[model samples]
Target chain A: MLRDITLGQYYQTDSLLHRLDSRVKLTATLLFIISLFLVNNLWGYVMAAAFLAVCIRLSHVPFRYMVKGMRTILFLLLFALVFNLFLTPGTPVVRLWKLTVTKEGIRMAAQIAVRLVLLIIGSSLMTLTTTPNHLTDGLESLMKPLKKLRVPVHEVAMMMSIALRFIPILMEETDKIMKAQIARGADFESGNLIQRAKAMVPLLVPLFIAAFRRANDLALAMEARCYRGGEGRTKMKPLVYQRRDYMAYAVLLLYFAAVIVIGRILPI
Target chain B: MALKLEHVTYIYGADTQLPVRALDDICLEIPDGQFIGLIGHTGSGKSTLVQHLNGLIRPSQGRITWNGRDIWEAGFPKKELRSSVGLVFQYPEHQLFEADVFSDVCFGPNNLGLPREEVQKRARRALELVGIPEALYGQSPFELSGGQKRRAAIAGVLAMEPKILVLDEPTAGLDPKGRDEILGQIAGLKKETGISVVLVSHSMEDVANYVERIVVMSQGHILFDGEPRQVFRHKRELEEVGLAVPQVTDILHRLSAAGFAVDTDATTVPEARDTILKALGGKWDGPAAGRGAMGEKEKC
Candidate 1:
């Protein structure tokens, strides 16, 4: 059951988006999220939706698989929808006993929900197309200027990659430990809230111990490999901006400029 | 009582883009008090099959029955099934978590809701059964040696007192001496308790040494199910599936091919020794006589 989580999971496919430089994809995703917030009316949202649709199609990621990532944030989406629906102070369209559903509130809620969904889909698309190593390389390269200000950009990137690498490993480990505890007759299900929380002690303790042991082993392995710092290390696949990246940058700039113009031209 | 799997099939990542059949149409009966060894290469569904025995995973296509009762029926008491069919996973030592070895061992019986005194009694018995000294029971499990941690983990499951013990590669990642000690204790436990055991191992020698029946799995199918001697006889078939016969059995086949009048059916060392001695016809004179007998046997 723990296997259902697809967080940071990359889907392998031979597509134009998958072949794009990780930095280009990352920058485009960031710009896409910014465009979602910058838009104010239906036209801008339509443009944003069209941009995302085109990217998703080009990536060759199945629409169903891309939507699966939304399940994890369903609760957040509902929460945002409800808050915007009920709490927004606008002209009431439907008056109930104490709550008023306004037309503006409905529009606001829909826009907010769409923005949130687009935000998640945009980020998930970046992760789904790029591998963790490529993502790290992109992040480190993006943060390279920070190194001049005494920031440990390489170390942070290394830690991020390691953390990403261990997510699936730890997930499998947790599943194994949970099964082991269950085989020992530990009841994790069918218990009261406190009882269930108490039962997690058995699961958590072992998981923590295993995590620390893995960390120690990883540290030792790195040390044995003469891994000093990220100071003077060269990447096997160095990040280079290709023509496709420039083309992607041009498209993102056009989308951002159009969204800004639409937001300024359209009345709320 | 017997555990039965009827046309059982399990598919991992079913309904996903890439579904894999981990076990396919497996039908087998595990009778009470029998020692069975499950041999397969990695990813051959050996682990998936054992997990099904305890209702840890429901089969994608078939039914599993415990003593003629379907385990997946409504209100079937899955917890009881799991407790009764204990599974000690590979690298089980990573599961140890309690403050001390004794408490970790007691985790199983305690989970069964046994009285405190009874839990303590079972925990001690399990610790003793796994050869964990009483004095070390109070020590933190993390502080124990690698082999001791593994034993404590096994004891944790043993304290559950399952009727059927399923161990998946129990001796994996251990030293040769450690492996023998763990396997020896498991064999002794099965003998003493008369509980059924399903030992999943890649080592043909370990299986040949302990189990009465060996079930060979390949590509999610049961390739062979018989006594070790019978299964090892199909050495070529087993090798095709990336498995090998016991070292002693291989040696016997080599000796037979070297023109000796020795039987190649021996699966263990003692059996091979006996076969070689018997082929010599009890001749006792000196090393020269022994060589002469061997030469005569080779000619024949």
Candidate 2:
């Protein structure tokens, strides 16, 4: 039952986006999200929508998997849409008993909905195509220049990678603990909110202890292997920008430029 | 009373793209007070089948009946079934969370809404049954050693006074002394209380020594189900599925293949010892003289 909960997990498949360097995908996602806010005109939205569609297709991640992440935030999207549609002031399109649906309100709701959906899809594409280790490695390499300021970028990256690695292990532990507690007649489903929260005490306590123990063991094993703060450590497969990576960066820049230029050129 | 699985099949991720058939039309029955060993290699669906025994995971294509009543039938006494068939998970570390060992053991009986005094009484009895000394009962469960922690976890389930105790690899990752200590205590507990036990383990030797019946599984199907001696007789087929007979049984098989007049189905240590001694002239003076005693014990 716990296995059904996916944390925007990576989908295993071979495609052009999967073959590209992690840094390229990460940078492309960032640029795409930035352009979502900048693009206001109808043509600009069209360009952004087209770009995302192509990226999703190229990534080879199932559309349903990407949309699953969107399902969790559906409430937030609806809230944003309702707030924008009824609260914004402009020419009235429809008048209800207590609220006015204005033309500007309609435009605002559409714009925000498009941007939010595009943003989620774009970011999830990166995660779906890249493994957690590669994503953190790319983040570390991208932030390497900050080492001059003693930012501990490598350590932060290592911590993130370890945290991601433990997600599934901890999930399995939770499943085991939950079943064990259930067998002992612990009632989790029928209880009121307060009682349900109280019932979680058995589950949460063991989970926290298991997580801490695992982290402790991991640290000791790393130390035993002479791991000392990632200093002068050469990676077995070091990050290098291949031809596909450069092509991806160029395409991303061109798309963002088109979106910005269209927003500026189109007055309507 | 008996727990029965009739054509039970469980498919993991059934609604997802990559579905896996974890249990495929398994049919088994567990009668009262029977010490049954569920032997399977990793991912042979032993854990899934154990969950079915207590109604934790409902079968997708079949039904599980407890005492002639469908467990998944509407308004079934599921809570009662769970308490009746206690499950100790593979690792004890993930289950014990109370401040002290005594309280941890009390959790199960407490969940059953037993009276306070009765809960304490049952918890104390369980701890004693598992060989947890009273002096250590007040200590934090986390402070106990690995084997002690395991025993405390088992006591937690046992405090519920289950008719059937299903333990999944209760002795995994322990020293031999710890393994033997825990298994021996469980054997004694079964003998004293007459509680049925379904021990799920990959260790042939451990199960052979304690259980009356062994059920061998391969790829989500039962391959063999019979007495330990009867099941180990198919050692070649068992090994093909990444499971082997007890080390003693394998040694006896090799001895018999080498033309030593010995039977290959003596799975336990004592049984194999007697079998080998009787083969080699029976005149060797050590424990060979005690063959009659061992042979007499096996008569039951």
Candidate 3:
């Protein structure tokens, strides 16, 4: 059941966007994220929304799945909304007791809500289309310049992929442990708040042990296979830019230029 | 005591786009004091079937009965049914949580609302039954060796004193000696306590020497259910579903087909040896070759 909360999981369908090089998707996502910040006007927001809709349609992933994990970010959205709704200094829109919401505050909050939402959806699109392996490869490739500063890009990338890979395995382990505990007459459903927290102890302790054991075994297996650091290591499936990837970059540049023109360069 | 399933069909993610019928029209009966071995390869719904035994999972269709009454009836005590049919899951040692083996084993009895003193008594008895030393009772379960942890985990379930014990792959991942010890302990426990057992396992050889009956499942259907000799007779059918009969059964079957007057139904190694010796009229008087049968005749 916890596995249903999968965030930005890949949609396994053959589509133009899914086939694009991971590097192109990553850079396009960055450009889209930058565009979200650059555009403040309604027309700018409209362009961003349209671009996102087109990308989502291209991805072939269901609209419902794209927003399934968004429920988790509702608290963060509310926090942003509340902060921006009353904190800006401008002409008063509404006064309630000691608190007054300004017109500029309303404007800023609305723009922020739109921006935050579009930003999440746009970024999630990249992850939705690219497999975790490709995502890591793209990240390592993108961060190659940082290797001069000894950032350990490949190692970090490997860790990210490994962590992603472990998510399902850990979830399955948790499900089994929970069932085992339940079979032992450990009641988890009917308890009050404190009772529920106390109940989780039986579930959590064993999970941590299993995780450590798995990690230990994995480390030994890796060591046995002579897995030293990322030093002088070459990739089996090297990341390469295709002709379609270049075209995607071109389209992204055009989109960014349009956002700047409509959002900031022209009079509102 | 009897637990009976009637036309049980379980479909996972029923409302979703791709619903998997894990168990389809599965009808099974567990009578008292019967050591029934459930055999199947991976994804044959062996685990799902065991979960249903203790009312941990409810069937989507049909019904299950405890004794004579329906388990899904309006006023049935589900919790009572759970303890009545104890389930020791595969790799059960992972469920140990208490500071010591004694307390961990007591966890089930405690949940049963037994008195503290009684819980302690049951824990001790279970630990002894599983051959866990009294000295190790107070030590952390984490410190126990692999086989000890596994048996201790089984003791945790046995503490409930269930009438029917369902163990899913209890001997998996252990060395041959450890496997034999655990299986022997289980068989001994059944004899001493007179409790029914449902051993869900992968190895036909392990069950061949131990269980009275074998239920073979494949693709959510019971392909064969009878005594070991009768069930293993369908060797071709079982192997088609990615399951193999005991090694002795295989050798006996081949020998019988190869014009030897040997009984192909011999499931255990010693039984096969006797069958072949009788057929050949050869006196296997070699002291080492004349090994006695390790299994006792299980009376149901």
Query: Per-residue lDDT of B1-300 in model 2, one digit per residue for the tens?
Result: 889999999999775567889999999999999999999999999999999999999899999999999999999998899999998989875688899999999999999999999999999999999999999989999999999999999999999999999999999999888988999999999999998999999978788889999999888999999999899889889889998787778888999999999978787767688788889986768685466665565443
Show where candidate 1 strays beyond 4 Å. B283-300
lDDT scores in order:
0.89, 0.89, 0.89
Interface RMSD of 2: 1.1
Candidate of highest TM-score: 1
Per-residue alpha-carbon lDDT of candidate 2 for residues A65-163, written as tens digits (9 for 90 to 100)? 778778778999999999999999999989999899999999999999999988888888888889999999999999999999999998999999998
Candidate 3: clashing residue pairs, number: 0
Residues A1-268 of candidate 3: C-alpha lDDT, one tens digit per residue = 5656647666677889999999999999998999899887889999999999999998887787768867778789999999999898899989988788999999999998998888888888888889999999999999999999989888999999989878878898999998888888888888699989998999999999999999999999999999997999998999878898889899999999989999886665
User: Which is better, 1 or 3, measured by DockQ?
Assistant: 1
Candidate 2 — which residues are off by over 4 angstroms?
Answer: A91-102, B15-17, B288-300
> On a 0 to 100 scale, what is the lDDT of residue B30 in model 1?
93
Give the count of colliding residue pairs in each prediction.
0, 0, 0
Q: How far is candidate 2 from the true structure (C-alpha RMSD, Å)?
A: 3.2
Looking at candidate 1 chain B, the ten consecutive residues that score lowest on lDDT are B291-300
- For residue A19, what is the lDDT in candidate 1? 91
